[model samples]
Target chain A: MSAERQERIEARIAQLNAEMQKREDYQAIIRLQRAYGFYIDKGYWREASDLFTEDATYEQGVDGVFIGRERIHQVIVKLSGGNPGPGLPFGQLYERFQLQPVITVSDDGQSAFGRWHELAMLGQYGEHAEWGEGVYENRYRKEGGVWKISALHYFPNFVAPYEGGWAVLKPVEGDWRSPELADFPPDAPPTVNYKPFPDQFTVPFHYPHPVTGKAVA
Target chain B: MSEHLLDALEAHLDSIELRIARQASHEAIERLQRSYCYFIDKGLWTAASDLFADDATGEWGQSGVYRGKERIRSYLALRGPEGLGQGELNTHITCQAIITVADDNMSAKARWRSDNMHCTDGTGSWSEGTYENIYVNDGGVWKIASMHYYVTLICDYDKGWIAGDIPMDPPSETLPPDAPPTEVYESLPGAYLPAYHYPNPVTGEQPKKPDLPELPESGEDTLADAVAALSTRVERLEDQRACEKLQRSYGFYVDKAMWNDVSDLFVDDSTLEIGGRGVFLGKKRVLEYMGIGLGPTGPQREQVINHQQFQGIVTVAEDGKTARGRWRAFVIGGSSWAPVNWGDCLYENHYKKVDGVWVMDKLHAPFTMYTLYTDGWHKATTPNTRPESFPPPPDLAPTVVYLTYPNYYCEPFHYPNPVTGKEAPPPNPAAGGVANMADFASEES
Candidate 1:
């Protein structure tokens, strides 16, 4: 190719990268973070799966090596459907994540990651409550002109039990009133609230695998 | 973050990657705790020695001295199983274990039971203790670096009281002398007696079905099941630790001035070392030391006693059975000339799992420095306890005894000092041996 043409090509590439940083894309990244926390808190496994790219990496739990969308789904499944609250019984939980400090864009303008110090808790559906406290190390990438979660990590600082046992989730502090939760019989036992106390933090998916950036087929 | 800065940061991180590899796991914590306890419980000196940093300064309770890891290891070998057989084995049952990871998860504070135990066999044997530990997670493994084992209760059953039943052996030097006519009894009287029999309650005989409490059966779960079960265990441990009710209980022991509860913090045949005060052999001696030193009759002489500046650090080993800690205490002793300045030495502790529960086996108080009205106190605080120039005390000397409270009156005497009434020149404490507060005072004065 001619030198002039080469310069033009490079210029075009830069322009395209800049175009990827549209306001919508930034908002989408924020939504991705919110969706990840929301789905997990509300037990919306399927929706949470869609927030990530088909082949995106998801690291969950203290060990951190837990990887892959399938593995991520597995952890979500274990968390949502397994012992303790197991989701459905808890109703549609209203989950809120307060992102703090500031979320930054990538220098290359192609990828961005947010180190969010999150204070998250859960309660019965329609109840404004919390379960415990933790923080998130989240990553986002612009793929096919859209921002999607490339990697998501969660770290817990403390795991204190809620009043309603290990299943019924409760926040540390907040006025959580759930009038809609009256569907359960007045004599219904409170759901067990389960919390995981993490000591070891491992990189998700300890199994050796190439870091593939291409979307999953 | 700039690429250059990020790359530099990553490189720095890589250099210290070796530390990351040694980061302690929950299991490693449990193992270290178990190893230390086993070292004390079964007297597995070799295994116990391997659990600490090679260059560690260990206090095997007050009984084991601290110099280097090698010295501690040798000491363990020298004080083998013979030291273990005395106390009826009791397990440490931890309901909550709180760990804070440092140096990439190599160190932590593991706090659990503030409760103590009394012998069911009426032998009056008990092991009540507390711990604050600083650990190093080495290569994904947890090893104790420094541990403070505070024996809140260290009482033993009178062997003479249960001679025929329970096949009681005469109290070894390693065990506490709970018999009558001993000097310790002269100071703290009526503190020991048989609690309950291990065998049938009526016969007062060693129960064939030993009355040892049964541990809750872990649900049928394989190692793979640990993925879930371990998570639950970790969570439960954390919650138990966070509960204010539990932490408040720990404050109770120190606040209530229950030093005899030291034995309950450790397993049977556990050792405790007081850097200044002479080493106390077993749980029995531990109780004696506390009763005579920190207890009501000790320097802590006061009717409305108050011990301020109490802080503790607990390190729960990955193995679960063993944990270590350091508890700092600022004591106020109202003497005539000047108030006594005492800092309870850091305790090096080892917990073991006997029948699946954690119990302390060896505890050591290695570093204690007191500021007295006398000038000798400054030199007394040095790490070294044995001084070269000081001659050894005679094999046995009359023990120090004094009355308690308002009628308190006792004579001040120097240890290793000839009773002939002549004080020797100060010695170089650098040469480690075994010296007491008297030696420290004489050298400083």
Candidate 2:
């Protein structure tokens, strides 16, 4: 057996392992995002917040920006109807069904960005039930051998009444920011100004079309 | 050694190719079926029919069977030309599926649900159906072997279902089908369930009755199905999963403040008791209590209350008709304007199987503790909500009244403890297996 042959065999194995690891990482990052979504759905604010890095930025729709893990955690707790701690309060349904994830890992495998569609079933028992459609362009960091959210951004397309649905949805009244978070205040202004539903905003695609390999405008 | 490595590499490549081939079969069938629907949506009869194999059989509702690729094209061509006109809208959105590729990789079966809309001239109609179709691998390209489209209903766009069901036209007068209807059955009003090509993936259980006659070389149990059936644990796991799904789904519904969806989880005569607010009898009565107490229906602009259900201990009855579960919920309540609070509760719930569907028959929840998020349980505590706290009262009075937080009340378990049946309890060992620093110190040095 030649030394060159052994070297070639070893290199082939290494290549396969690297490819497999990337696929595994893709699944793991998706799992992390999905778990984060489940935590948010159940109003497990602390759990949802823990999925982020120490320094992370959280932004949703026109809700400006909240920076830092602690601040973002507080904002997550506040944004999810202001019930803090282990669980959501009774009669509040904030189901964020994480769906259709298209993830892309960087060359180093240390960072990745995922585009996900969020079909949110939001409501309060007896109050008002809303069906929300949104897209998430989130960034994740691999630190300490675990994937965590680095920057979270969600483009809310619409939040319409469950009864009439999106068909009867009127345009946003103002900035679409929850009035409750007014006192908390965002660290920065919204990344972009946009209207949803009746109006249109294409949440930028993180990856190009598979076949065309052309950027999706 | 180099020869051995080369052989190993060959084996590895073979394994990868085998897995890829199976997956490719799934993708190919999905693409073929989806493309057929897309072509059909635009009245591209020739293009859609081209997807059919040389000797494929196509069945549409009560329409007689059309055999062969050319005959299939002729049948579809009855719908008119290549493409629809301006006001002539024909939209077909097909989604949700169960795809099964043969272990031999030569054949496949798929079930698809389609929602269709068609507007001819000015008259519009809606159509919905299930497609239990078959596909064959021709060399490497997959093509439709059998397309069985069982229509659920076709109704007027405005009137809907019973009020406006548009009956299926008899065999086209000019160009009739090759043969009689395969499995004749009426739409909507009739009870006709098409037999699934594959059994339950988990339990490997298929219902006793299968309506349609089998096609060639398919619908038989595969090796995976046989292996899945060998496990006695499958049925229990399936039952347990169903119960867990119910609890998780109920929790999510409540988290979004969707009482209507939450209430729908319960049976018509189900009973619910939240805290000491008393038992809310029947689904409607429970909903009435919520509608009256919680204020309105839907997402609250400022307030949020999430009853996060967790740690469910479910025990299915021997008959499998009923089940009891005990679950705990940690409540996060209040709004930005209002003071936020934390609460924990225990639930002893009962579920009953009706028409093969599991619905909550009884939801008995007992509040354990309630405290302000700012003040903490050690400092400030909120009293449990009561009957008088809300306006229109409950249907029944409190069953078991108890004090919450600063006080303790055990919510009795519905199932006996797993360890309770043990003859003896093991004594705790203090130091026998304890780690000694000296034992591992040499390795560290």
Candidate 3:
């Protein structure tokens, strides 16, 4: 073999190794945040989408089953009620986060499987009851030279009773619920009655909201 | 390429693969007990030794060290009649192991739990502690070359709690009286028992066994529950790691002055034979060795013996009534003059599943070499006598128990409880208390 050809092959191997390492690191960070319910409450749609791939699969309801990144986007659309970003205050979302024990990385360092736990209150589920409290077992993959979440499986550790009605709401007058107050229209003064998806809109995985009895997207 | 060079390359690659296999084996060993502590507590040594390398090394106490498969076999022969035969004392547990696999897979570090505590009597005295370990892949098989344990705590039975020795205290104060007599917690050795032997079915009338408690039936099946159940199995595996920890605790006392408890860790008729030393039989004789080795004159005098680091490779039987375990013990014993090395000796032990619980059936401290200094005079033989006399002068004790007890997670089987007509739970934890929030908080704190 020619010396130049050998050198080129070596360089490609080095590049691929570096890429794999970087992807692994990136995926670990995303997993850490996702398991803690950080993105769910913050409602970071695009960023959350970036964490996963265009064809990523997801499931975070009573059923513990979901597939396809597009479906995840649709679920988020319902979460945001057509809003572009996560609506909850950053403090409220990131407040309760705890990493799980035994985070396992693959031998080749290209993939990882891990679990994490979190605790939080979900007004979206019902009348301001603590909802986000559970562990998540996740699988990640390297895609297009970047690590993206390939699958996220979620379930609550324990469910607590809630009081307030659960339905995505647009903050109205005197409500300190949402930090993005400027985004609301003056004429339709953000009302709790605003339905994100049309009433007839039927989304899959209809886990009943802890409070409102409405399907959780 | 020269054949020699090829051989060297192949050896290196083999070493790497072996290391990885060792790491996985170590992880499995660590989880053996917790996954089947119930089996271990019942004294199943034959099943327990399956976790060990064929040519495992170990020792009984500090006095004898055995090497090679032949010696291990000899040691096992001596385990019976040593009070570790079957259905003797209940094994205790406390474990935590950290395993790291090398990229090449030739060697690995298994930072394991050493907590092996036991209860000879059905009360609260617990002889507990920790161990240390180093696992190497020897010819594609992970074998423990060195293991040791540091004994932290040893609690003997309190005679006052017996039905007659002293009146049972009534629940009075929220916090009990402060500063009770030190004598209450003082270490006094010797068998304290009512001799509640199991029904021999020949001579004496056996006590009627109580009705077996019903287990919660498997609930409705759901995918989520199935996944949760998977985690539960993993949790069980994690708990199995505690078996080595429990052995370590037992080692501490055995290394020190509690030979009976160490013997109790095995089946009643167990035998032990370390190289150089002749064989010892029954729990009583094993205790005699403990009394001498860990006695005042042993070289490790003034040094507390306990399991500070430990690991186990255990396999459960298909019937769930038998198993065998091979483990390593890293001792942390010795005083200023002779401090115990943190990493030492690999203990090859055997276990059994009598009834439903796990217990040590045979223990072989096959290959233990010591590195410690101390004050007492080194004596080839002592006046303290054979097997029963432990706590020998610091100078008399060997540096390590070359072949330790109950090889990796080998499980054993036992006769069914006539009353329940099923396996019985091993004795309760020596540290009496329900496993609950309070215990968790105390452990965390």
At residue B423, give the lDDT of candidate 2.
Answer: 20
Listed per model in order, the count of residue pairs whose N, CA or C atoms clash below 3 Å is 99, 28, 187
Lowest-sum lDDT 10-residue window in model 3 chain A: A194-203
Per-residue CA lDDT of candidate 2, range B52-72, in tens? 888999999988999999999
Docking class of 3: incorrect
Better of 1 and 2 by TM-score: 2
Question: Deviation in angstroms for B199 in model 1?
Answer: 44
List, residue by residue over B200-236, the lDDT tens digit for candidate 1: 1111221121122222234664222322333333323
Against the true structure, whose lDDT is highest? Answer: 2
* Candidate 3, superposed: residue stretches over 4 Å from native: A1-217, B1-246, B274-278, B296-301, B335-343, B373-445
lDDT of 2 at B161: 47
Where is model 3 chain B poorest over a 10-residue stretch in terms of lDDT?
Answer: B373-382
Model 1 chain B worst lDDT window (10 residues): B404-413
TM-scores for chain B, in order? Answer: 0.33, 0.48, 0.34
Q: Calculate DockQ per candidate and list them.
A: 0.01, 0.07, 0.01
RMSD, every candidate, angstroms: 27.8, 16.7, 26.6
Output the number of the TM-score-best candidate.
Answer: 2
